[model samples]
Target: MRFATWAGGAGVVSDAGLHPLPSGVSVLDLVCSGLPAALEAGSSALAGPPVPLASVRLLAPLTPPTVRDYVAFEEHVEGVRKSIDGVGGVPPEWYRAPTFYFTNPYAVVGPFDDVPVPPGSERFDFELEVALVVGRDGTSLAPGDVDIFGYTIMNDWSARDLQAREMKVGLGPAKGKDSATTLGPWLVTADELEPYRDADGFLALDLRVSVNDTLVGQDLLSNMGWPFEELVAYASRGTWVRAGDVLGSGTCGNGGCLAELWGRGHDVPPLVPGDVVEMTVEGIGTIRNRVVSGVDLPPVQAARPRPRIRRRDV
Candidate 1:
């Protein structure tokens, strides 16, 4: 079943419209409680009168506990390596395992919310990705042990100029990425995606992105180098992955972001205020956001060098 959260409350999406869940039950609560319980709750809620989808203001499906985004597409890595690092090939270390980085959970916004150009940023961009919400807590998990509650479309909004500078410091995509990340429209349960699973067990869903109503890029979810299960497993290694934690399938290949196109010598313009960016994952749903101007502030003070501690001989 597909579920959504709106200003009123959480609801199950259907042909009739949205079937509101119990007053206090939220999408995050259902996700933490597990699928069987959510199914039971949804079953009971279906008896109530449905609300029209267009009438309510939709919000982000849930506020994730944490967000881990992985680069699961080699094509995306290859495409952006040059532009981001001024290098032309995928790094050898990337093949050893599915790698990811932590992004700010607090920065998440709804499918149709307005995303501001991060303060001090100019080259704003959007990344088309698929993200899965964890159903339960687990540590040191294997691929088969991953538990997923559902899937949603993710737009890992980027501030390319800021990201490039941060990467040079060998530490972050921090402030550059912490500005905003988009998830929602709604979340679709794993069972609903069964029909789209390929022979190799990967979801073969089509993904597309558009800027201001013009199609910019499209690719297949099947193009991912590592499946969601594996990415989850890697994320679980030596750490706990709990319910409501979101893990993204990274950027899709072919033309997931403007950086990738720029690396290939394409002259796509950076996102500007008033530009509407939309991303769609076939089985899931579409998430559209409008870019808006951010609050301008003066540059932060630079870090000062600290005196090194003298080591005493043992």
Candidate 2:
């Protein structure tokens, strides 16, 4: 079943119709509601009459309790690293396990929402990714026991200039990434995606990104080197992975932004105040957003104290 969070409440897309779920129900409620049983019951129950699609506003379909975005594609890793410096190569640890980081869960943007540019951000970019949602909370889950709730398209908006500066300090991609993350069109449950799974358990979906109707990047979901099972398993090693947690399967191969593109000498037009970005996944639908310019940035002329360096014995 395809589930969505709309203006009224949570709902299911079944029999090719949009049916309202229990009143006051939200996607977060479903995530925490014992996924396997909830889904089974929801699917078995009689759904309410179809709601007019146009009348409903689609939100992110989820307000996850926590978000962990992983870099699982070697090509994306190499491209990102290569873009920063002249050379690029995947790190050895990447092959040993899945690598990820925490991002702002409250900063999520839904389909059709307007994404504002961070003031003074000269290099804004888009990343095409696949995101997963956790259904039941579990810790130290075996790979086979990692039950995923659903899937969606994730557009990880980026500020290249700020990211490059911060990452050099060996600390963050924090302020650079925390501003916005676009999710939706709607979520397709894992049961619905069963047919697309390969023998190795990876979904072979066509993921793409477009700007103003022009295609920029495309890749198969099967291109990923690490299975999400490892990601989940690793995430649960020491801490509990609660229900409603969101995980992203980083950018696909050739699914790059203006930074990687520019590094390769493509020199595409940069994002401005009103450009539209669309991300689409085969069964999950698309999330389209417009760039809204930001205002009231701190003045560049503000003075700051200089750092004092410590002397070392020669």
For the record, the alpha-carbon RMSD of candidate 2 to the native fold, in angstroms, is: 3.6
lDDT of each: 0.92, 0.81
**lDDT tens string, model 2, 1-314?**
67777776777766555677777777778777766766865675434577766777888888888888988888788777777656667778778888888999998988889999876788888888888898778899998999788888898888877888778889878878888998887778887887988998889999888898889988888889877777788899988998889999988877556666766667687788889998888978888999988775884664578767688769
Identify the runs in model 2 with alpha carbons over 4 angstroms from their true place.
Answer: 15-17, 44-46, 299-314
Best by TM-score: 1
What digit string (tens of lDDT, one per residue) describes model 1 on residues 117-137? 998988998999999999989
After TM-score superposition, the amount by which residue 22's alpha carbon in candidate 1 deviates from its true location, in angstroms, is: 0.8
Instruction: Tell me the TM-score of each prediction against the true structure.
Output: 0.96, 0.91
